[model samples]
Each structure stands twice: as structure tokens, then as C-alpha cells.
Target: MKFFTGFLLSMVFLALASCDSGDDAGVPDKGYRYFPLAVGHYQIYDIVEITYTLRDPDTARYELRVETPDSFLNADGDSTYVVYRSKRLPGEVAWTYLDTWSARRTPEELVVQEENIPYVKLRFPPYNGQVWNGNAYNTGERDDYQLDSLGQGQTRGAQHFDDCLTVLQHDNEDFIVFLDQRKEVYAADIGLVYKETTQLSYCTQPGCLAQQLVEQGVIYKQWLKEYGKAE
Candidate 1:
């Protein structure tokens, strides 16, 4: 009887130890994994863009697929990723290559350029209310980007993400006002799960005294459809 009781106690202790180990190996603490950039990491997102004009508002919806094909040496002799992006409008049979962009991720920030304009997409160790100059490299205009909030739970498609992030970029000039807002959600073991971007350009007419709606605005939303990692 004593031998059986000892065996039972040993089993219970082993079970408890296993449980603790499993918990430790589970999800990690809120680390700097908000954006997972790796070679061969690919993500497909459904994009919807809307543009406002004086005559009529135009809505153009499409699908944007991005994949990190390979890395190349930059001027600083560091490996920079070359992201290949493609776009396909709804009802289109084939996808068209949009452009090849370069991205570099350092311990501080993820720097990317779109249409020859460099911008800091994200900063490390994301925290609420953190502000940065997104348009630091832009000569035309400067924009202020801030982490509006964190831990915003969001669901996209069949997957659900918790503790998502929301960032906002806005700028105001003497006559023209621009705002480009974004909400991005990341998932463990995967890169960007969901993202949404809204851009607005408002200005007043020259003759009119008050601010007139010259342009309605534009909104772009993207969701993860499927992903395949390159080995």
C-alpha cells in the first residue's frame, strides 16, 4: 500500500511539472513581434480602396498579395529584403505586378518606401501614445504618426487576434489637411493578419471662405486571405 501511494505521488508531481513546462512554452510575453519579417514569409490580403472626387466618388476594390522573395545587400552592406507585390482587381483573371519595394528592419524601426517616399511603418516595442515622424524623409510634407492604442482585439476571416494595435498618421497644412490612419493586427508565427488604411485630403476652395469638400477621401482595407511560407 505504501509503494502504491508513493507511485501516485510521483505521477502527480510529473503531471504538474509537465503543465508548468507547457505554459512556459506557450505564447510569449508581448515582445517586439508585432511585425514578423522573414525571407519567404508571404501574406495575401484583400484590398478595397475608395476615392472621392468632385463629380462622383469612385470605389476601386482589389486584392494585394505581398511576398518577401529574397534579400539583397544594401549600400550599408546589410541584407535588405525585396518585397514583391502584386495586385488583381475583382473579376480579373490574372494578377499584375505592382512594384518591387525594399524594406529594412532594424532594432529601432521598420523603414519602407512606397512610390519613392520613405516612411517608418512601425517602431520597436510598440506602446500606446508613442509618436514618431512618419514622413521624416518626405520632402513634400511631414506627417505625425502615433500609436493610438494597443491591445485592441480584432477578428479577421476565420482567425481571431487579440491585443491588436492601432496607429494614426495625420498632418495639417495651411490650407490642405491630410490624414492617413491605419489599424494593423498581427498573429504569432504569422506576419500581418489584418490591416486597414484610410486617407483623406480636404481643402477649401480659393474663392470660398469656408472649408469646402473638394475631395471626399479614400479608404483602403485589407484582410488576410491565405499565406504560404517559402522554405
Candidate 2:
């Protein structure tokens, strides 16, 4: 059985390259510009997260706003952007700070470190079907990241984006056996648009495994609401 959960964009003209990974550090390619990692750039989103436990399932709807307000140097001496994230529930005018995320845009890759898990969010020169190991830092697991689409238009809610790209990330079979399945989607310039993860395990008898497998599963969906550039 499956439980249904109900869910929840923007424009700024910044001349950036689309599709085409340029040469190495010495090469002057604008391919990495698709993401536009600047101090004054920010995005707001409406998020819906549903969790299904063995006993009951619940849903949470909130508004998430992330902003690139500050920057600092990391241990490697690379300057990184400080992404401040805040959350607001429905019918509330105040936003509370949730956490802080870090993004480092190198010539080769755009690295995002969230919750202490570092992810190579994007490789230079965006192209269709380009695959990379996003979970290279984690020794216990490997996640496959691929550029599913590029140079196409995408629309969500009342906002529309041109020259957009979508990247897909998936877990390996070993991880899937325990997690069921996990998938993530990221849009060019806009960042993450949608994400869905399902976890289901089966056992012949109760208490047969360390953790009991339930008939219910959790699902989460996030969509872009509105976005703007900082002054």
C-alpha cells in the first residue's frame, strides 16, 4: 500500500555558459557558471516531507529559504560560500534558522557540504548523461550522479526557467537493499527542485531482523516557490 502526500521559481539574467565542460584550470570555460555561486544569490522553496513509520504516517509542510550571505576559507584555504537556511511554517511571518550549509565552486567541481556530508554537486561543463561518483568521500557507500538533461526549459509553480539542466542521483544496489530506492533532482541555476526517497524491507516473521520492516513507506517532495537576487 502507498500513502499519498500533497506538496508544494524565478529568473535573473546572468550570462553563464550552458552545456559543455571547458578545459582544465587553465582553460577559460564558463560551464561552471550554470550554478551561479555568488554572495547575493538566493532561492526560496516550498517543501513537503512525509514520514511513514510502523505505527503511523505524518506529513509536514513548510517554506524553506536559502541565501548565500557570507563567505569564509576552509581548511584547504579555498574560499567557500556560507549558505544560510531558514524554515517557516504555514501561517507564520517569522523564519527560524535551520542550519548552515557550505558550497565551494572550484574550477573542476562545485562541492556542497551539508550536514557534514560533502557532495560533489556538479562537474564542470554540464552535459547530458555525464556521470560521476558523488559519494567519493564516503568509504562505505557510492552514489551515482548523472546529468539527465541540459539546455532545456523547465517550469515549476508560477516561475519558468530557460536554459535549464537537471541532474539525477541514485544509490547503488547494496544501499538500495536497505533503503529501497532514493532519487534526487537538481535544476541548473535554481538548485534542487525535487527529491523522492522510498524505504521498504520485508521479513517473513516479526522480530526476524534487527529492525522490523513495515508495510508503510515515507515520501518527500520539494518544489520551487519564488526566488530573487539579493541587493
Candidate 3:
């Protein structure tokens, strides 16, 4: 009888231990820090855009600054922050207003609207290989954005980030005809650190068909040059 009582106690202790392990393993990591947003926060990026056409390719270099200086409550009672975008030439001292956008964050996801098109930037508790439609809230065609990697280190130009993640927005290429690839990387506290987009159409002419000559489209790259909070 004593042996039986001791065995039962051992089983209970094992069950408790198992439950504790499960609780620890199931803790969710709400990765909201990767896209942190707040009033007075701003980021500056160096932009390089290359446009391809039947004529000579044109390249342009500029600096872009995005600032969040105000917020308002949307119809749904959720607070949405206003994003002000401005640009200046490489050596220019004055900035030209480009446009205004908006961004909202909830417990579940982050959404940003640009040119009246809303895009689901990232889903909460992001996990590697997770996929979702970036245009879920907009009228645009469906675009599957995937979190290709998470909690990884990334370096861009002279910047180094310890905790970062890469989102693969689109990647469809046919060297003979066309290419479309877009990706964005976000650091833990700095938001978007790097973005690259390439949309090109190859010439299908008999002579250039095999050469993979880019006939048209643009290649855009933006790298974070600095970030800070406005007074």
C-alpha cells in the first residue's frame, strides 16, 4: 500500500513538471517592437532610383524623411498616426513635401496607407515563414507577403542591427521576359532599415530575347541613414 501511494505522488509531480514546461514553451512573442510607432519619431533614408526605358536608363539619388507628428482617432475608435513624407536632393539643405500617409497599429497587426491604398505591413507575433495578403484591406490585387526570416542580424551600409527580420513582399522573375522582386527589412526598434524593389521587363525582340535586356521598369532602393525623435 505504501508503494502504491509513493508511485501516485511521483506521477502527480511529473504531470506538474510537464505543465510548467508547456506553459513556458507556449509563450507568444508579440513582435510589435519591430515596427514601433509613436508621435515625434522620424527616420531618414537614402534613396536611389533607377528607371529603365527604351531609351537610356536614368538614375536619381535623393534623401527621404518620414515623420509621425500627429494622430487622430479613426471611425473605429482606433488611433491612427499621420505620416509625413518629404524628400531632398543629396546635397540640398531644404526638404520638399512629397505626400502624406497614415499608419495604424493594433494588437493583431500593423497597417499603413500610402496613396489611399492600405497595406497590411506585418501581423502580430510574427513567425518565420508566416504569409498574409498585403492588400487585404485595399482594392489592389492580392499580394502575399511572407516573413522570410526573423530575429536575425542585418547590416546595411554603415549600419548594423542586432535583431531584425526580412519580409519578402513579392518575387516573380522570368529572365527571358520580366522580373519583379520586393523586400523590406525591419530592425527591432528602428522600423524599416532597408527596402529594395525591382520591377523590370526584358526585351523580347529576336536579337535581345536571349540577351535579357531590360526594356522598362524601375529599380528602387532605400537604406536607413538616420533615425531620431523630433522635439
Expressed as tens digits, the lDDT of each residue in 1-231 for candidate 2 is: 122222100111222232333545346654665667778778878887777766777889999998999897779777799999999999999989999998998767888888888888789877789998888765537777888887777776666767666766764443322455555555556666555666655343545543445545666666777666889
> In model 1, which range of ten residues has the least summed lDDT?
171-180
lDDT of 2 at 169: 75
Q: Which candidate gets the maximum lDDT versus the true structure? A: 3
Please give the lDDT score at residue 194 for candidate 2. 56
User: What is candidate 1's lDDT per residue for 1-231, written digit by digit as tens?
Assistant: 999999999999999888778644665554356666678988878877788876677877788889898897778766678889999888887879999887777767778777667788777777888888887767856567888777677788776777576666653332355655666666555657777766666765576424645476777777888887878
Per-model lDDT:
0.73, 0.71, 0.93
| Whole-model lDDT, model 1 | 0.73
Model 2 ranges with Cα > 4 A deviation: 1-30, 74-77, 171-188, 199-217
Q: How far is candidate 2 from the true structure (C-alpha RMSD, Å)?
A: 16.0
- Clash pairs, candidate 1, are none
Give the backbone clash total of model 1. 0
Q: Estimate each model's TM-score.
A: 0.71, 0.73, 0.86
- Best-to-worst order by lDDT is 3, 1, 2
Write candidate 3's Cα lDDT for 1-231 as tens digits: 999999999999999888778544767679988988899999999999999999999999999999999999889878899999999997799999999999999888899999888999999989999999999998889999999999999889789999999999999966778888999999998899999999999989888896879889999999999999998
Candidate 1: list runs displaced more than 4 Å.
1-31, 75-77, 171-183, 201-216
